[model samples]
Target: MKALVKTEPGPGHVELVDIPEPACRPDIGVKIEVKYTGICGTDLHVLHDTFKNYPPVTLGHEFSGVVVEVGSEVRRVKSGDRVAVNPSTAVVCGTCEYCLQGYYMFCPIRRGMGHGVNGAFTKYVAVREDQVYKLPDHVTLEEAALAEPLACAVQAIEELTDLHAGDVVLLSGPGPIGMLCLQLLAAKGCRVIVAGTSQDRLRLDMALRLGASLAVDVTAEDLQQIVLRETGGIGVDAAVECAGAGPSVLACLNAVKRLGRHIQVGIIGKEVTLPFDTILYKQLQVVGTLAHSQKTWVRVIKLLNQQKLPLTDTITHKLPLSRWQEAFDLCERKQGLKVFLSYDE
Candidate 1:
């Protein structure tokens, strides 16, 4: 089997290598033949060594595939079943309090796919059966590949953040995660102001098309002015930061009303200088979130099955696994949106 492996530590250490096919452990493993694996921002972090990822591991977590084989103990799925995976449960201390609460990402010894263990950037991946989620009848494999990020969005917006219908929101960065978060906010009936830099012209436009009330090019136009205009000088009810940039963070802090919710969904790999006093003076309800929960995945799957969001437009680039570098380049350049790597011959 050919897999995209991060062979060693440091930047640019990844390569396409021929490795032995994975075997399903009889008790709890499920071997899947991957169809479409979407490139996530975290994968870029791993490739740059800014994020923690064990070397000699495959590098993908957002994927949809067909079950080729299932372990003896697996009862949820069987051969030929189409499914998506919840990578956060790849390796966890099942007895921990967090796992028991369905928040597997916080399990003391949790190791997610793509970072801790081998992921789905190849022909076949054998994950714990518990991580496999059967795709709904109406969900295409391409759409299912995005369930991971959508689940993360659900966790950030619906679960972790406090937002109400008709509230004005400031959504920073129009990346894949940010865009998905936009959809969730739209569904909640929130009036969204999507912000991005000049480079994000394409993404910002897509955000408006996806139901955002306004799309501000922060680099050219003033974001704070627009926020005040939309919210009648009261600032937005909530601000979701997904750009991972220091300026975007400051913008969110500045645009959100005093005592409003400020949710951080982007992973800023390094610490950057910010106005720490703002959070204190504003008395804001600030929350930082990461990784999806079991319940959130369930909600995302339901949303997809119900055909509530038109997610196909977000998928702008598709390349075969052999063209992994090109796919990475596309993401790095912020060319379009979600980039999918396929396993087609």
Candidate 2:
């Protein structure tokens, strides 16, 4: 089996290596023949050595595949079943308070797949059976590959604030997660304003096509002015910062209404300075969210099954495993929105 292995620390240490195929552990794990795996922002972090990742490991966490073998204890899926994987929590200490309450990501000893262990960037991967979700018959494998990211978006929305119909939302970044947030908020009847810089022109345009009420170019136009005008002198009910940039965070702080919620969904690699006085004066509710929960995955699958998400356009490029460099380059250059690596080729 050929896998994209992060063989060492430091930048760009990844390579395509011929690795032994993973064997299913009876009564615990299942072997999947991976079909499509999406390259994510986190993968880029891994390449740059900014994110925590184990070396000599496969490098993809978002993927969909067909089950080739199932452990004896895995009755949820069987051989030949199509499935999407939830890779956030591969191992957890059940005795931890967070784990006991079903918040496995909060468990101190938790080790996520693709980072803490091997992932699905190969022809085959052996994952714990509990991490697999059987895809519906109507969902294509390509669409299912988006489940992991969509579930993260779902968690962001559900855990952030109580969004009501007709509420105004200011979404920053317009990147993959930001775009997904735009679609999810729009579907809930929120009038969303998607904001980004000049580099995100195409993504901002896509946000409008996907149902954002407005798209603001933060570099050229005043985002605060647009929010005020759109909200009739009031600020947006909630703001989601997904760009992971300092300026974007400041913009969200300025655009959100008094007593409104501000959700930080992006992963900022370094510490950022924020306006503490504004948060205090406005009595703002600030929340920081992590990865998706099991419940979020269930909701994401339902949304996909219902054909509610505009997902086809999100996937702009697909390349073979051999062309992984090209795929990574496209993503890093912002030339495409959700670049997928197909193993079937």
Candidate 3:
């Protein structure tokens, strides 16, 4: 098998090299033939040594695949079943309080699939039987490849917050995760305003197409004015920050109405100075969210089953495994939205 491995600790140590194929063992649970894997912001971070990652490990986690073989202990899914994986399931302490509650992301001993252990950047991957969620016939492998990110959005919006239909939402960053959350909020009948810089022109346009009530380019337009006008001077009911930039975080804090929600979905890698008084004065329900839970995955699959969202609208690029660097560049340059990679099979 060919895996895209991070050979060493550096800005550019990734290589597409041959490695031993993961065998289907009773302890490993299941073996899957990866069909499509989506490039995520975390993958880019790992590439640049910005995110915590182990060396000599495969570097993808957002993927969908078919079960090629199942260990003797595996009974949840058959060999021919189409499935999506739970990234956090690869390594976790099952006895922890967080894991006991199905929130593996909070487990102290948790080491996720992509950065923590070997991931699915190649033709095959081995996963625990419980981590494999059987995909419905209605969902294509490409669409399910985005399930990991969609699950993260589900955790932020559906599980953590108190947002409801008819409420107003201000979402910053028109990137892939932001776009996914926009559609989810839209489906809940929330009128959303998407904010971005001039570089996000294409993404901002797609945000409107995905159901944002307004898309404001922060560089040229005033987001505060737009939020006030859109809400009739009341401000948005909730402000979600997805850009992870300091400006976007402050904008969400400033635009959200007093006592409203401000959900942090983006992973801000470095520390930045923030207005500490904003939370105190506004009395806002500020929430910090991480990865998805089992419940979150359930909601994601349910949402996909209904087929109400136009998820594919955000998929702007697709390339083969050999062109993974091109896909990475497109994402880093913000040239497109979701980029899917397929193996040579």
- Span of ten consecutive residues with least summed lDDT in model 1: 129-138
What's the residue-level lDDT of 282 in candidate 2?
91
* lDDT values for all models: 0.90, 0.88, 0.90
- On residues 1-345, what C-alpha lDDT tens digit does candidate 3 reach at each position? 788999888887998999999878775488999998889999999999999998988999999999999987776899899998888778899999988999888888788887899998899998889889998898988888888889988888888998899999999998989999998999999999999999999999989889999899999999899888888898899998999999899999999998888999998899989997898898989899997888898888887788888988889998999999888999988998999888976
- Per-residue lDDT value at 336 in model 1: 67
Q: Tell me the tens digit of each residue's lDDT in model 1 across 171-281.
A: 999999999999989988999999999889989889999999999998899889988887888999999999998988998999889898899998877889999899899
Which window of 10 residues has the lowest lDDT sum in candidate 3?
22-31
What's the candidate order when arranged by decreasing TM-score? 3, 1, 2
Instruction: Show the colliding residue pairs in model 1.
Output: none
Candidate scoring better on lDDT of 2 and 3: 3
Mark the regions of model 3 whose C-alpha exceeds 4 Å error after superposition.
Answer: none
- TM per candidate comes to 0.97, 0.97, 0.98
Q: Per-residue alpha-carbon lDDT of model 2 for 234-337, expressed as tens digits?
A: 89999999999888899899999999999999998998898789999999999998877667777887888898778877888889989999999988878888
